[model samples]
Target: MQGHGYAPPPPKRPSTGALVVLRVIFVAVPILSIGFLAWVAPLRAAIVTHRRADWWIFGGSLVVLGISFAYLSTDHTDDFSSPNGNVGMIILLLNAAACVGHYLYADIRHYHRLYPMVYLPPQAPAANYVYPQPPSPYAATHPQTPVTPPAPAPHTPAPHTPVPPPPQRPAPARIDQVRAELDELSDYLRKRDGHYDGGRDGR
Candidate 1:
C-alpha cells in the first residue's frame, strides 16, 4: 500500500566542465576580460565570505589598471623605453598580480563549495505552532452586543418617615377635662399628707 515517507534525497550536483569553458572564454576576449577580472572575481568572493579584504583588492586592482592605461597612452615611442618610461608596464604588472591573487582565493573557495548555490529544504515550523481557530459562522449573522454593566439604582432619601408629631399630647384633654384631672390629682395628694399627719399625732 502507498504510504507517506520522508522526502527523497536531493539531486546530485553537476560537473564543473561548463564553468571551465566559461573561464576560458573570459580569458580569450582581450581587453574586456581584464575589466571583467578586475571586478567580477573579487565581488563574488566578497559576497560569499563577507570579507573586507576582497573588496579592497578589487578597488586596488581597478586603480592600477586606470593608471596603467593613462601612462601607456602618454608614451608615443614605439620602442620599449627605460625605467622612467616603463611606469605603465610596471603598473599593469601590479594590476595583473592583484587579479591573480583574487582569482586564487576565489578558486579555493569554489573547489570546497564553501558558498555553493543549491536548493535547501524549507525549515520546519517552530515547536509552539498553534493552529488558528476557525471563525464562527454565527458571529457575522448575529453580532453580540457589548454587555455594559447596569447603572446603580438612584439613592432616594428614605421617604422622611413622618415622626407623627409626638402623639399631639392626647389633644390637650379638651381644656376643661385637663382642669378636672389636675383637681383630682391635687385632692389625692392632700388626703395622703393628712393621713400621714394623723398617724404621727396618734403615735
Candidate 2:
C-alpha cells in the first residue's frame, strides 16, 4: 500500500530593512525641519527674506542629505540586493536636487507670510473722484401716509334645535331562570328517547 505525502510549508517573508529606512527618512526629515524652525529664529528670518527658489533649494538639500545618511548606515545583508556604495552616493545627489525644489517653495511662502501687501499699478486720473449724482429725491422726505383698517361686522345668532336621546335597554332576567328552562328542555328530549338518567338532575 502507498502512503500519502505531506504538503510543503509556505515561504517566509523578506526582511523589511529598506522599508524601515525609508520610513525613518520620511519622518525624520520633516521633524528636523520643524525643530530648526522653532529653535533657529535667525535661520527662519533669513528664509523669510530669501527668494522662494532659495528656500526650496535649502529644504530639499536637507531632506536629500538626511535620506542619504539613512541609506548609507543600513546593513548590506539586511536587504534583498547587495548594497552598492555608489547607489547611496547617487541617492544623496538626488536628495540635493529635491532640497533645491523645497527651498524655492518655502521661500515663496515665507515672503507672502512676512509681506502681505503688494504694490498696485498706476493709472490715469478721472474727471471726478466721486460718481455723478442722480435726480431722484430722498425717500425720507416723501414719507408714506398710514391707513386705518375697517371695523368687523356684528355676529349673528345660530338657530336653536333639540336632539332626541338614545333608547335605553332593560336589564337581563335571572341566570337561574335561564338554566331551569334549559334543564326542562333537556329532560323532555331525554324522556322522548327513553334514555333519561337521574344522574344529571342535581346539576
Candidate 3:
C-alpha cells in the first residue's frame, strides 16, 4: 500500500545560504512598516514550517484588503492628493507586493515543483489493500505428490545352533580316606626302623 505514494518526507531545508537570506528578509520586512511586520512575519513563519497558518493568513489578508478597498473606494480622489498620503499608500502597496512575492519564493524553494499536493494533501484514511500477484503456471497444473518413504527392509532370522554345556570334573576324596592313607604310611616307617635295630644288635 505504501509503495504507491512513497514520496520522501520533505528535504531538510533552510540551507545555510537560504536561511541567511530568509533572516535578512525577515529583518527587512519589519523595518518596512509596522503593519507589514505584523502580517508578513507569521505568513513567512508558517510557510517555512509548511503548516496551515500560512493559508489562513494569506486568505485573511486578502479579505481584509478587499474590505479596506471597498471602504476607500468612496473617497479615493480626495485621499490621493493629500500630502504624505500618496507616499504612505505607495509604501503600503510595495510592502504587500514584497510580502506576496517572498512567500511565493519560499514555496518554490521548500516544496516540490511537480505536485503541489505533495507538501500538504487533504486528510483521508489511507488505502489498506494490496494488488495480488499472479499465480505460477507450474503450480496450477502439476500439483505436488506426497513422497512415499521406502518400505522397511525385510527382517531375516539368522540360523540358530544350540551351544553345549562344558563337562563336569570328578568330586574331591573324603576326609576319612585321607586320614587312613597317612596312618598306613606311619606304620610302614615304624616297621622299617624296628627291622634295622634288630640287625644291628645281631652284629
Q: Which has the greatest TM-score?
A: 1
Candidate No. with top lDDT: 1
TM-scores of all predicted structures: 0.38, 0.26, 0.28
lDDT for each of the candidates? 0.67, 0.54, 0.62
Error of 3 at 96 (Å): 6.6
Residue 107 lDDT in model 1? 55
Clashes of 1: 0
Q: Put down candidate 1 lDDT per residue, 1-203, tens digits, no spaces.
A: 98798899865644679656644453333235544345555555566556677778768767777787788778877853845348877777556656655665675565557436778899887887888989899998999999999999999887676666555555665887989989999999999999999999999
Runs in model 3 with CA error above 4 Å?
1-10, 26-46, 78-203
For candidate 3, the per-residue lDDT at 24 reads 68
Q: Could you tell me which 10 consecutive residues in candidate 3 have the lowest summed lDDT?
A: 109-118
State the lDDT of candidate 3 residue by residue for 121-184, as single tens digits: 6776558657688989998899889999999999999989888989875446666677789999
lDDT of 3 at 148: 100
On the 0 to 100 scale, the lDDT of residue 46 in model 2 is: 42
Minimum summed lDDT over a 10-residue window in model 2 is located at 34-43
